[model samples]
Target: MNVALWIAAGLLAVVGLVGGALKVVTPKAKLAAMRGGEWTQGLSDGLIKGIGVLEVLAAFGFVLPRMLDIAPVMVPVTAVCWMALMVGATVTNQRVGQGKLAVATVMYLAIAAFVAVGRF
Candidate 1:
């Protein structure tokens, strides 16, 4: 279970880092032009950046606390936050008619839920 939790968290961290970094660095226009990025069209730049920041933070939260042997409770908390973020992503994708992206977020949400339940 521990190994599985670590694997899940690692995967989540990698995704959060990559996705968040892209959101932070990419311009709104570019993101909106991307295939799965149409959802950004309905959001403000600041909100997008804010979500990116949260994602980066959640990435760290998923690993750092437990790895450092500190407040390991943060792992599950991060999982919950990731779940919420994924839910929002799912809804936003659905609104933009990005069914594929919505399905992807659902997969991520499932992974987060698995990590949350396993860690808790």
Candidate 2:
């Protein structure tokens, strides 16, 4: 379970970091291509970038504090934040009639919630 949690954390962190960096650095055209033009349907570029940064920060929050054994509470906090973000994503996608996205968001949220319970 611990190994699984760590692997999940690492994967989540890497994805968050890479995704955030892309959002921050990529142009609209490139981003649109990557998202198959779906990402921009409801979200502005600025909002997308902002959420990306927050996700990256939350990913760091999941690992850094716990690794250093200082303010380790941040790990669970980050997990909760991630879960909240997924919930928001799920709701937003559902509102926009993006059922696939909503399902994915819920899946991710479930993983985050499981990690939160196990880690904290």
Candidate 3:
């Protein structure tokens, strides 16, 4: 169980890092992809950038604090935050009729939940 927890933690950390990097580097393109051919026009760039920054911060929260044994609470906090974000994503995608994205969001949320439970 400890091994499983560590593995899940590592996987989620890597995913958060990579996803955040992509969000920061290619917000427009990624948003487009997420929207499934729908234009993200009228959406505030600042909002997108904010989300990107948050994602990166959450990514760091998932790993750095735990590794340093400093502010270890951040790990669980990050998991919870990611879980919430995934839930939001799932709802948003479903409302937009993007079934695949919705499914992906659910998967992410599940992973986040698993990490949370395992760690706790």
Candidate 4:
């Protein structure tokens, strides 16, 4: 279970870091033009960037506390946060007619659910 949690955390951290960085740095128009990014069309730049920041923070939350053996409880808390984010992503993608993306978010949500239950 420990090893599984580590792997799950690593996967989510990579996804969060890469995806969040893309959201944070890319312009709204460019992001909207990208594949799987149509949902950006309905969101404000500030909201998008804020979500990006949250993702980056959640990435760190998954690893740092557990790695440093400080406040390790944060790992499950981070997983919960990720689950919430994935729920929103699923909804947004569905609304934008990105059914495949919505399905992908469901998978991420599952992983986060696993981490939450396993770690907690």
The whole-model lDDT of each prediction reads: 0.92, 0.78, 0.75, 0.92
TM-scores vs. true structure, each candidate: 0.97, 0.83, 0.83, 0.98
Tell me how many clashing residue pairs each candidate has: 0, 0, 0, 0
lDDT at 109, model 2: 82
Predict model 3's lDDT versus the native: 0.75
- Which candidate's lDDT is highest? 4
After superposing candidate 1, which stretches have Cα over 4 Å from the reference?
none
Query: What ranking of all candidate models by lDDT puts the best one first?
Result: 4, 1, 2, 3
Kindly indicate the candidate among 1 and 2 with the higher lDDT: 1
Predicted structure 3: clash tally: 0
Error of 4 at 23 (Å): 0.5
- Comparing 1 and 4 on lDDT, the stronger one: 4
Task: Please tell me which model should have the higher lDDT, number 2 or number 4.
Answer: 4
**Which stretch of 10 consecutive residues in model 3 shows the poorest summed lDDT?**
34-43
lDDT of 3 at 63: 77
Model 2, position 56, has a per-residue lDDT of 83
Could you list the CA RMSD of all candidates, in the order they appear?
0.8, 2.0, 2.4, 0.6
